[model samples]
Target: MNIKELQQYVSRFCDEKGFEGIPLETRVMYLISEIGELTDDLLEIKGATTEKQEVIKRNIGHEMFDVTWNIFDLANKLDIDLEAAFKEKMNINENREWKT
Candidate 1:
């Protein structure tokens, strides 16, 4: 689904799960924690044997999704439209030059 849809879903989930009471600072902390988890999953997969990597790969997607969900939740809590923000950022990037 698109960013907007995903944000809406997370908002609804938070409301249903009583996570609406969570403060923005806590949300930011959670997002950071999820990022760490995702990084750990990536590192595990990278260093694992082929067979073990396959097992770790399965958990990697969930970690990635957790990161995305936390980001969307943070955006929602801050009342930011991630889809619009993303598009605006991309437009600015397209015209910008990068030093390689």
Candidate 2:
């Protein structure tokens, strides 16, 4: 699904899960927690020496979804179009020169 569809899906899921009452600050905190989980997964993968790499990667994906879900939900609550904002930000980045 595209961003909008995913946003809708997540919104519905959040609603059904009784997450609709979460405040913006709570969402931000949850997103931050998910980021920490993702970071831990990444660090494990970077230092991995076993066959659990795939498991860690899967965990990382889950963490990423958690972050994105909160982002979409919060954006919806704030009436912000994340897709547009993302595209606009990318346009600016695409036009800028790298500082290599």
Candidate 3:
């Protein structure tokens, strides 16, 4: 599905399963925490920390998805319609590029 479809689908899934509780900021924090964990995994192999590389990589995928989902959630919450907005912005960019 496209971005808007996916946003609608996720919203439906969230509503159907009674999965509402945390605030947007909390989701953002979780996303940041995941990014930190992923970074730790990458850095640990270079003697930067003690976390395991393989384990951290696995968690990183989940965290990255968390980050993506929240971005979609925010988009949907604000009725921003990212799929169309992106297209609109790209058209402007295409018209403006190298126009000096």
lDDT of each: 0.90, 0.88, 0.70
Give per-residue CA lDDT, model 1, range 17-100, as digits (tens): 999889989988998998898788887787789999888888888888998998888888889999999999999999999889
TM-score of each: 0.92, 0.89, 0.59
Q: Sort by lDDT, best first.
A: 1, 2, 3
lDDT score of residue 7 within candidate 3: 83
lDDT of 3 by residue, 7-84 (tens): 887687667876455577876776677667667656655653345655666766776777677777666656688889
Candidate 2: worst-modelled 10 consecutive residues by lDDT: 46-55
- CA deviation > 4 Å runs, candidate 1: none
Cα deviation at 21, candidate 2, in Å, is: 1.1
* Model 3 TM-score, all chains together: 0.59
Q: Candidate 2, clashing residue pairs?
A: none
Model 2: per-residue Cα lDDT over 15-80, one tens digit each: 899988989999899989888988988988977766788888888889999889888998988988
Question: What TM-score does candidate 2 reach?
Answer: 0.89
For model 2, state the Cα shift of residue 43 in Å: 1.1
Off by over 4 Å in 3: 19-27, 45-56, 95-100
